[model samples]
Target chain A: METLSSLAVPTVLILAGLVMARGKNAFDAFLRGGAEGMRTTFSLIPSLTALICALSMLRASGAAELLTELTSPVLSVLGIPPEVIPLAITRPVSGSASTAAFSALLEETGPDSLAALCAAILMGSSDTLIYVMGMYFSRTHVKKARRAVVIGAVGAVMCLFLSAALARIFFRDAA
Target chain B: MIGKCFFWICSVSMVCSVITGNTSKLASAVFDGCADSIELSLSLLGMMCLWCGVIEVFRDAGFVGALARRLSFILKRLFPDCADDSDIMGDIASSVAANMLGVSSAATPFALSAMEKLDKRNGCGDTASDDMVTLSLLGCSSVSLFPTTVVTLRYAAGSESPYAVLVPVLICSVICTSFAMLLSRLTAKNKPLGKEKRKSLGKRKERL
Candidate 1:
């Protein structure tokens, strides 16, 4: 995993070398790109602010816990570990909250425990679906997301179930 | 759609907080959330700029175009409606590549650029086009080869074999992404295209 991450930089360096070899001024192009990136970030702020605030409100009001309690029984019946239910629920909503839930689970269950492994797999396999949708759609004039939400929800639910099932299959003996 | 969801989320949180006598915490969360969003975006700025810069260089070097060509078969299948638009295809290619690398800061700019182009192609309509929905779905359920953040968190949490979950994550993500693609394609077919576009396509088919 570490080696994979280390490769990301070198890949960029090789790309830059190619750019220079092609006789383009790489540094000048980079500055132009940087400016464009700045504009993108600024445009995204309002949407990000709205989403983060709502998510945090959901987290703080104890609604998240209530929702988890309501869903726990069905989730358990589907073979999801009870301890990682919070992680599953938050995983698609917000990235930071899910990370916090993940670490909290690790601390509670111990890093080597079945629940921790399951949570790890769950967190690793999925992106923050709702957050990504919000950011991606914010720029568009599109009001109705149509079936996008349903599609994302389907994918996210599949990841959650697969994470639990795969963790058990791969790590049951180790646990 | 998103506005309604966001409105309800905030309102429900407020109502739940009041009923549970936790308004103070809720109030604090409101401020914290705003502050956190800014902080997060600012922190991401440097990386976003760096990667976008690299991507700009890639565009100039014609590498992004080459990538679009290389991935044409699958991308064409995924984006049937707008597959002929090389600009859209190029942005999608770069974004997907960044996503696979787990470099989201880089991915967002590229994906957003693609979204803008798709929006224009859709005539700046309020309703999302089929290709737009597919792009967002693909972005949401991207098949990331490296679950870098999760591995680091596990390692910090004292897991003996932090990378042990790599294969499982890979399997799960690949399956989920495939499912997402299939669902989007199926839904796109069922939704029915706009009248003019459909007729045009039919006419083109007849001509062919």
Candidate 2:
């Protein structure tokens, strides 16, 4: 599965090339499309810069850690492990940051631990919603993504709660 | 609105850092963040260009159209306005498929292309349309049948069963995606009415 997933992009490229053979102006079309993609990428620079900067500053300022500490009490009341609070907070904003936090959790509490398992489940089940929203909205030049952002946040919260609950159910014995 | 929120949060964080005597750390973070964002965008550029080129080939060869036709039934229900726009539909289908396979890097380009096409179809408005919101929802809560990243991380961490979280992850993803869909549907009807209504009312009063 790992090999196949890694090869998926190359496979699609090959197939696309084969399909392009039937067309007379494949090269021109490809270049045209590539140019369009570049344009989109360039347009995304401002929004991406703002968002990534904000997120990074939020992380580096220790605000994220403080927020996690503040939320841990509320989260524990809902049966969530205090350990996974950082992962929950970071997962939606930055992918690499959350992955690092997840790795730290696994190291702190063995991989077999309930906290590690919950972290794994939460990471897999949800996505970096803010990042995705920023990219998509910027690419499309959509200024008002208020609704999409709200909905994505709600979905992320659902994923967090459900993952924690399911982890408790499934890893009860392991913990 | 989202941009403003980010700005305020960022400002607040900077203020807190300064007050807490973390000025040096904050300065480094700003520089590092700028550099990181540039690197990230460049990497995204490479992937987007590659996939866009390939997809263009598919489009020229009619494969995209064929794929769109194949998935039209479901796509129609999900994005009714895009029923005739096979290019957009094809991009959406490919994006969702790649996401399901856990090839998220590949999915990004497709999703962006689909959003671009959807925006064009919606007359390039500044605000996102309902279809755009739905697509964003799907992208954010993408249901991955094979979460290779998590499994690999678990293996590296020396788990007895790296794939043990598979079932729970899948179930959780389904629930999350469903909730996203439901929320999108419920909110679709409640378009921001404040500015539009005030403007229209002012026009009506002036005419009267």
Candidate 3:
């Protein structure tokens, strides 16, 4: 896996080589592309700022924790292990919160346990659904993104159940 | 919808903070959040530009068009509206490839480019087309081939078989992506409250 990521540099060099072989100015193309990226980055900053502020306030005010605790009972009824509930709840809202919850889960459940396996898989399979929605939709002038959010949330929930089921099947002997 | 949700989140947090007597903490968080976002964007800008530049080189060399043509078999089904447009499909192809490879930094630039192209294609420029929703949906439910960060975390935590969850993660991601796509497609028929319709309705009311 590490080797695969390491290949990224070489892949870029190869593309650059291919461009140069065509007798065109790869550097000039690169500079223009970079300028385009700068524009995209600037456009994204406003929404990202608002989103991060709201989410951080949610966290700092302890509302996020309250919400998670409120949802845990319903989650438990769905067969989610109590140990992984916090991770699942925080997974879509904030990436850093979920990572913290994940490490906490490993600490509490032991890394080789079924709950830990489930948490790991859940983290791996899912992205920050709400954050992605905010970032992507910021690019367009769309005012209505409710349906997109609903669909993304559904996908996140699907990942949650699928992760638990797969973990239980593959790690039957795990503690 | 996003605006409403943002408003609700902020208001809810403020109310919760007052109730919990953590108003000071919430106040601090507001500034901290702004600072953090700028820091994040700064960190992201480097790799974002690099990947965009790299992809540009490929685009200049005509490699993107060839790759798009090759991937259109699958891309066509996912983005029927963009199937005939090599330019849009090419951007979408790069975005999807970067996502699958778990290079999210690389993916965002391409994804942004694709979103811009899709927005232009939609013509409305104000309302998000079905294709735009689907593209954003695709980014959210990432079907990564190698979830690098998760595996590394597991290994760091001393798991005996850090890679044991890889297959299951892959399976879960695939299932999630397909299900989301199906839902998006099903919901695609209904147009959102488009500006054109609203404008026409307002004119009709004014004449009345």
Each candidate structure's TM-score, on Cα atoms with residue i matched to residue i, is: 0.67, 0.63, 0.63
Worst 10 residues of 2 chain A by lDDT: A1-10
DockQ of 3: 0.41
Chain B alone, TM-score, model 2 = 0.58
Considering DockQ, where higher is better, how would the candidates rank from best to worst? 1, 3, 2
Question: Which candidate number would show the highest lDDT if scored against the true structure?
Answer: 1
Q: Report the C-alpha lDDT of model 2 over A1-175, residue by residue, as the tens digit.
A: 3354346545766877776776679988889778877787687667666665666676677775677688778888887777787678778887655655575567568998988888998999999888888888888767887999888887887787788899999777867
Residue ranges of candidate 3 with Cα displaced over 4 Å:
A1-74, B1-70, B190-208
lDDT of 3 by residue, B77-186 (tens): 77765656878777788777767755466678888888888877777467678888899998888787666556655665677766677778888889999999888877
| Residue A116, model 2, lDDT | 88
What lDDT score goes with residue A131 in model 3?
A: 82
All candidates: interface RMSD: 6.5, 7.9, 7.4
Clashing pairs in 3: none
Question: Over the full model, what C-alpha lDDT does candidate 3 score relative to the true structure?
Answer: 0.75
Q: What are the per-residue Cα lDDT tens digits for candidate 1 across B125-165?
A: 99998899999998888877657557666666677777778
lDDT of 3 by residue, A1-175 (tens): 4344346456656857777677558778888877777777777778767776777787788887787687769867776665777678768877655655575567557888888999988999898888888888778777787888889888888888889888888778986
